[model samples]
Target: MVYTICYALIFLAEILISLFYFENKFERKASKKFLIISLPTAYTILYFARLFNITVVNMLAFFVCNFFLLRLCYKAKIKSAIFHCSILLVFNVTTEFVVMLFSAAILGTELLACLDNSVNLIFQSTISKLLYFSSMYILSKVSSNERRKESPATSLMLFLLPISSTLIIYAILYSLAEYELGQVFLTLLLIGIVVLLFSNIAVFWVYEFTLKTQSRNMELEYEKQKLKSAAEYYDLLNEQNENSKIVMHDIKRHLNAIKSIAKDKAVTEYIDDFIEDFSINKSVDYCNNPMANSIVNRYKSFCDKFGVKMNIDIRSADFSFMSEPDITALLDNLLENAVEAAQNTENGFIDFSAFVRKNKYLSIQLTNSVKNIVAVKNNRIASSKKSDAIHGTGLKSIKRVVKKYDGEINMKFNEDDMTFTSNIVFEIRR
Candidate 1:
């Protein structure tokens, strides 16, 4: 009965730890009732395995149970589910080995003798649980952000933690069981194991900090690129507008010259073509903000070149609430993604609309036809381009701007119609 109780507590602790890890990585789908039922079901399987003294089967059953539970209770891919389960299992095994080894050493007895006593079993399990929970708490404090992926170096180190812990435990146990190791040697081994454990935690914290720094730097670089692109687009539009003004100013003179040379059909046709090509009507001012207008018009030209139809409906409003750079980055990314998606379809088209609702909210929507819809993970649309690092930064930049303004953005795709849609809403703080 004591053994069963201890096993139940250990299993419950493992489940809670797994829950914390999964909650960080994936959305939860299971309810409280599901958890209540699943926990005992998992424990029962392990309990029966123990009854049959099937060590290998017990390990396999534990992993299988946790893997399926994670898959059923969370929105995670198979690879992610396996990775998480493996981490949990390694943590549990390492903690158990360390706690058992230390407990036996302190009790001055064989490891088997320690496990045979209910008092010792409870003590060992409690110590193991404390160590496991403490490590998890420190890890959470160290890596508070959602890490979409781990670096290869970090992954290798994480794998080594368990292996090293197991080896250390094995060496201590073998020394105690096979030979008479002195107190000094056992003490030193224990100290070394403790140091190794702390070092693993320190390394994890440092790697997480490094990853965070790298991520911030990438975002800063992306913002710089965004600003540069916006400035160039603004300048190009301004130059085109100036050229149109010059042509318009001399329109009367050109028309009169064309009339005079009407007898020569070639010259007259050439002048008429020039006027048509340099029509001032081609310049579009969609909003009160010049930068926003420039971004829209620039993408409009891109769509025209790609034989994609662009439909734009923008209202005049005071956009002084947003900085010029923020507005440019937001609009440029939206339009660029829309144009790129539309450029690939047979009947490619983009529908863009922006307006103020109730004088307090600015709502913008962009819908485009797509040949293939990209997958979204954690509410982020994954980049389909080969250069994920470069192509993915645009959306990340836009998200930063939206977050800065306490705005909301939604994205959706329709597989049946092969269309992608984005809606962004910002509260206008007057």
Candidate 2:
């Protein structure tokens, strides 16, 4: 009965720990189902293996059960599941060893002998729960909010580090269980266990720090590229605005000549064609901001070239709350993506609108027809372009700007209508 109780408690602890690690990745219903099915089965197998004194089989069954449970419940790939399971197993072993050590010290009994008492077993299980929960809480607090997929090499490294450390600690515990140790040796072993525990924490901390640093660097590099693009766009718009002024001045000078030649059908036709050709490339100013207007007009020309109809409504919107670069980057990326998607569809059309809502929020919405099915991964729109890293940067840049303003961005796809919609809302800062 004591052994059964201990096994049940351990099983519950394992389920809780797994849920803590994978709560964000898995659905609650699926997680509950996994716990219900996997826990009892795994505990039964481990219980029989322990009863038969099959130590090696017990350890193998433990890891194998966890790997499969994580893979199926979290819907993770095999390698990712293995890495997660290994980390949990290492923590479990480390906590058990620590509890055993403390219980032995308090009871003045050999480490292995503590397992013979039901009180010690319950004490160990309770301590393990506390340790695991505390450690997970600390990790969750310190970890980055961005969820990046780990590289295979990094995942393998993470999997090995904890397992190796746990094994070393377990070996020390086994040695303590087998024979009495000198004071010097016992002290050294305790120090070694402490170092191993700290080393495990350090490894994970360094890995998370590396990921955060890499993400920040990528953002900086993208910002640099965005700034360069905006600069060139502004220059082109300024030149176009200047050329339009020149063309207007020339037209004024030719008005008298045009009126005199109006009686001649051939001369009038020539003058009208020249005016039309010159004005066709002129930029359309949409909002109070010239930079935004330039970007919209540039994309409008692109849409015209590709036979994608564009409807834009940006009459009295005030976007002065955002910087010039930010405004350009946001509009440029959104329009470019819309135009690209629309160009691929027959009779494609884009609808874009920006306005202030109730004088408290800036709202922007873009809807465009897409020929291919839209794919979203990790809540971000997956780029269909062959060079994903290059083309994917646009959405990332837009997200960065939105995040800076504490705004919300949402994307929805209508399968029936074959339309993709992007909505962004930013709180107006007084």
Backbone clashes (count) for model 1: 0
lDDT at position 112, candidate 1: 65
Clashes of each: 0, 0
For residues 1-430, what per-residue lDDT tens digits would candidate 2 score against the true structure?
A: 5445545545555555555566534333355666678767765665566565465666677688777666666656678777767777677778778878876785468887766754345445555555664466345534635366658686666757655664555455546556777867655554444444445555665665687689778777877887787768786886878687787877856964776758887777777777667663477779887778888888898999999999999876778889888887788888888888888889999999999999999999999998766765554654454321113667778887999999999887777988888889999888
Q: Residue 267 of candidate 2: its Cα lDDT? A: 74
lDDT (Cα, 0-100) at 125 in candidate 2: 53
Per-residue error (Å), model 1, residue 159: 7.9
Q: What is the C-alpha lDDT of each candidate?
A: 0.70, 0.70
Per-candidate TM-score against the hidden true structure: 0.63, 0.59
Q: How do the residues 1-430 of candidate 1 rate in per-residue lDDT, one tens digit apiece?
A: 5345555555555556555556555667789799778877876776676566565776787688889888888777899789767877777778778888776786567776755654445445555755675566446545545544556665665656645564555556555556766757755554454445445445555665576688788778867986887777787777778787787868958686766868988878877787777656576788778777778888999999999999988864546799877887788878877787788789899999989888889988888888775675555665455211114667877888899999998877777888877788999988
| Alpha-carbon RMSD, candidate 2 | 9.8
